[model samples]
Target: MKRPSAWHLVLAPLALLFALPLLWLLVSSVMTNAEINRFPPALIPSGIDLGGYRYVLGNALFPRWFVNSMIVSAVAVTANLAFGTLGGYAFARIRFAGSKLMLGMMLATMVIPFQLTMIPTFLVMKSLGLIDTLGALIIPSLVTPLAVFLFRQFFVSLPRELEEAAWIDGCGRLRILVSIVLPLARPALSTVAVLTFLSTWNDLTWPLIAINSDSNYTLQLGLTTFQGQHHTQWAAVMAGNVITVLPVLLGFLLAQKAFIRSLASTGLKG
Candidate 1:
């Protein structure tokens, strides 16, 4: 059998170090309120208690909040992928007057912090009469500069031979993009989808600003209110956290390989 490398000696402990907090959260979720509040903070429970899970499931608004988050994330991810692909393809393949200046200006937006733009964005949403609705959340995130930049980079890296051959066969740009290029662009697609999903799913600040109605609240915003509503219920709070984080963790674990591959292929990994 092959021996393990020396790096394993350092990494094994670090892995445990990172996992410990998640482990404690899971443990605490199953503990009773009394167990959680005990002196020294009980690390193990005497018996399983489903009360935390019960509280969350039985709350009508919590489930509604989960659904709201799913709706916004699904729409945002789909929109970003579709439009980012089109805009990126244009930048990568088509020659247009002022294209370089336009691309540079678009990329420049990425450096400006969200803090500076938040008020202006809020004013725009208010002007459109989208405030207090899910539309406010979906409109702004339809596409992002990073998505366009990544797609442009990946599309540029593709060998022109493929597109040229398709061109010889009388295939138009759209047909080539849909039928030829996209098939080989899975790594970039996966990276974009996973990133857009994570960002949209975990977003709280925007939802907090846009959604004033209880029915429109996303899970993160709802959870913030949940904690305030039931401050003493540590177990329930931990349970809510687990529920909130589980989807993102599972999603990243499933797509991490493709995500990493996309980074390397696009020259961003370096």
Candidate 2:
């Protein structure tokens, strides 16, 4: 028989410690309200009860909120991939006047806290008449500095020989990028898509500030309606959270390998 490693023994408990809350949430979701509030709490439910899920799914407003979230996330992910990749490629391969200065400025903006710019962003949205609309969420999240940086680094690592050969064959920059660069950048693209979708889907604070109408609320924002000053529905909240988290969880699982590879390689050259 093989002996267990010391590292495994050390990591086993830490893994479980991190997973305990998710396990408790799953267990509690299937317990009755009374049982959930019982003394000492129950790690295991006596019987499975899906009343919480039933309540959340049965509500008409929940579906609308879910659809709204889907729209925002999809749009943001598409825009991020398209624009971020284009900008990154330009920064990596093109030698234009002020290109380095512009790239440096964009990177610097990433360090400034979003809180300091929140008010200015809100005013810009108000000026564009996007407030109280899903556009308010999607427009601002279209691209991010991190996504651009990731793509730039990945592009910079690719051999210039491929692009040079394409140029010799009379391929324009755009054509070369579309035919050669993008296909080779699947890992970085997948990483950017998954990250953007997760961030947009889980965002609540900005949505709360921008959207006032319940009809315009995203999934995260609508979930807050379940809470009241006098009473809170814990079971419903947990169920809603599970539903909201499912898509992001599935996305990560599908792209886990590519996502990790992209992140690991992002700083390799730039």
Candidate 3:
């Protein structure tokens, strides 16, 4: 075999460094509690055990948390995509007073840290009696500034001639948007959908603050139940992390092609 170049040698180590933690998590998930708590961690378990997974899957509440997370993610993603697409279309195709100011203000909200607004948001949710309900989590994420900005940029890059042609054929703005632009904007829509889903799926802090009852806990927040001040179940914690992350990882894997295509196409237009 030919000798690999120095660039290949450098990249080989970098790739291993990035993947090592994930590889360790996979191995540790199958290890015994004793092995996980060993003075020096076992690089490889002597025997594979399903105890950790069994514990997690057997917990009746785990299933509920998983389902709640899905509900919040699904509802939030749908709202974001629907509103984001329409908002993007209106901002891109329609011209109205203070449009530039409004766009700038929306984008500015994206830069504001969530921490700054958490108290106010929580108060509002409390006032609306949405606290401790999944609605608290889903409602806030329904209109993400980032999703709106991305969709607007994507919409602006689309050719206006297609829309004008549709209009000339007696199609109204709503019909033209539905039949023409949305179909052509699939890649961008998919990109937004996947990103929104992942964000809502992995969300922990907001859900933690908004959700007070164990019955409405999300998967990510449920992981905290595995930790204790006196002793931590490292193996179970790792297992929960693995389970919590698997859906998101799988979702990205499924949508990666559409995401990359959208990024490439959007970049070209920008």
For each candidate, give its TM-score against the true structure. Answer: 0.92, 0.90, 0.89
The global C-alpha lDDT for each of the candidates, from Candidate 1 onward, is: 0.89, 0.86, 0.84
- Over the stretch 1-270, how does candidate 2's per-residue lDDT look in tens digits? 988889988899999999898878777778777776767766678898898899889987888999999999999999999999999999999999999999999999888987998899999999999999999998889999988988998899999998998999899989988999999998788888877887899999899889989999999888777554113567767887788778877777787786566556555633
Report how far residue 180 has shifted in candidate 1, in Å.
0.7
Candidate 1: RMSD to truth: 2.2
- lDDT ranking from best candidate downward: 1, 2, 3
lDDT score, candidate 2, position 79? 96
Indicate the worst ten consecutive residues by lDDT in candidate 2.
226-235
Looking at candidate 3, what is the lDDT of residue 214? Answer: 88
lDDT of 2 at 136: 90
Using TM-score as the measure, the top candidate is: 1
Q: Tell me the tens digit of each residue's lDDT in model 3 across 1-270.
A: 988688978898999999999989888888888887878877789998888888777877877898999999999888988999888888888889988898899988876999999999999999999999998998899978767778888888988898987888898888988899999988778888887887789888999899988889999888776554213567666777789889978876777787566557547744
Q: What's each prediction's clash count?
A: 0, 0, 0
- Indicate the worst ten consecutive residues by lDDT in candidate 3: 225-234
Write the number of the candidate with greater lDDT, choosing between 1 and 2. 1
Preferred candidate (TM-score higher): 1 or 2? 1
Error of 1 at 155 (Å): 0.8
**Candidate 2 vs candidate 3, TM-score winner:** 2
